[model samples]
Target: MIAKQVNQKAWFMVLPVFLVVAVSAIIPLMTVVNYSVQDTFGNNQFFWVGMDWFRDLLASDRFHDAFLRQISFSAIILAIEIPLGIAIALAMPKKGWGVPVCLISMALPLLIPWNVVGTIWQIFGRVDIGLLGHTLAAMGIDYNYTQDPVAAWITIIIMDVWHWTSLVVLLCYAGLCSIPDAYYQAAKIDGASRISVFRYIQLPKMQRVLLIAVLLRFMDSFMIYTEPFVITGGGPGNSTTFMSIDLVKMAIGQFDLGPAAAMSLIYFLVILLLSWVFFTVMSNIGEESSNGGS
Candidate 1:
């Protein structure tokens, strides 16, 4: 057989995308890196500070508390959203007009602007005017998010779930759709229960997409800002102040650019590291699944 000539034309096709990404992403990243290492007093004034800001951030109790709160929020969000999404997806019709209707409805929340979501929820949770808050108050519950830390936390968590669970649902639903009917047929032929079919066939097949869902949710939740900020304003004694909010407060509120930049870099790294871990674990799981299939 004659050796086929390798196509060089594909490189030309990809070049524009590379150039666009470099300009939009890499240049801004370099700016952040520069800011992370330097001090700026005012217009055009700068001095090198090395790792001072990093050390200070690491030692600060405020930073530690924010970190812990962020981690906890992310964990809770993942725990609630992933399972709930899966359940909703499973319960949805396998085929019909209902499928598109369900998908479109689910996607509606995601289509809303982030700031708009925050504003809507902020008004929605007001005890006097909001349906939820008014109903809760009428039911004799003390449900003032403005004064109660627990209430604020609960509201924020619930709001996040309402806003983002749709994403998880969509991803899981797509994964479910991609699964071949032959597997389900075989499971049915063997008299497998619903649970057994889900466990042995569905769950395994959806692992890769679920991994993507988990990573996306984790990163988004961890870096969340606008919703909580608008609703709680990091209030109720900073009980709802996540790392992203704190970073914004430092960078803009305090005008501490150097430290803020350092913290931001660290924050970016933490996200990158966690994403890497998720990717590695998913890759291993995929490898094992492939080996087993073979």
Candidate 2:
């Protein structure tokens, strides 16, 4: 057999990306790690603190509350967006002019910037001049997100659903399109019910895409800052103060560098851990499904 040499030129092509990542991500991460273990006083003086900040954060009630709020927000987002996206995708026309119209409409929300989304909703939800707020007031519902915690939470959750559900819809629509026509024909021959067709065929086919959607939604919802910050300012008395928002307050608002750095690292690790668990559980389910069918 003749020996074949591998191409060494690929590494050169990838070097620019590697350098960019190092400059953009790696260096800032290293700086945060350095800050995580140190304390600073005036006159640019510093002292070793070594996990004290992390310990305090772990013991703090505020930190626990922020974490719970973050988890709750992500949970609510996933619950609302996933099934809704799937339903919308299923209802969309598979072919013809309506398909483009539906797709374009779905995509428009995603095209808006996050800050702009928050601003639009903020104005839209005002009790004075905004249409939604004015309509609700006319209906005699006392709604003010600025003063009510429940209202603020509801506003942010709805804003997130409006913004990101299109991503899930698009992913799921692609997944459904990938399913061969033969499967539907088989179901038709078997006189399968619509629910059965969905449960056994569409649902199974969408597992991988659903997994992707779930993970993406979870991470984004967990780390959400810009939209909620602009809309609610984490307010109505810490009602919507998620981990990222709280972390920003600790770092920028309070100038608590050590604690903020520690919290950021912890935040990253929690997201990483949960994503791994989701991927592992879904991959196992997929494998079992494949084996059972075989």
The C-alpha lDDT values of all candidates are 0.92, 0.94
Task: Please give, for residues 1-294, the per-residue lDDT of candidate 1 as tens digits.
Answer: 998879778889999999999999888888888887889987978899998888898999999999999999999999999999999999988899999999999999999988899999899999999988999999999999999999999999999999999999999999999999998899889999999988878888789889999999999999999999999999999899999999999989988888898888889899999999999998799879878977
- Model 2 agreement with the true structure over 37-69: per-residue lDDT tens digits: 998764667789998999999999999999999
Q: Candidate 1, which ten residues in sequence have the lowest lDDT sum?
A: 3-12
Alpha-carbon TM-score of each model against the true structure: 0.94, 0.94
Off by over 4 Å in 1: 1-9
Best by lDDT: 2
Which regions of candidate 2 are displaced past 4 Å? 1-16, 42-44
lDDT of 1: 0.92
Pull out the clashing pairs in model 2.
none
What is the TM-score (0 to 1) of candidate 2? 0.94
RMSD of 1: 2.4
Per-residue lDDT, model 2, residue 236, is 84
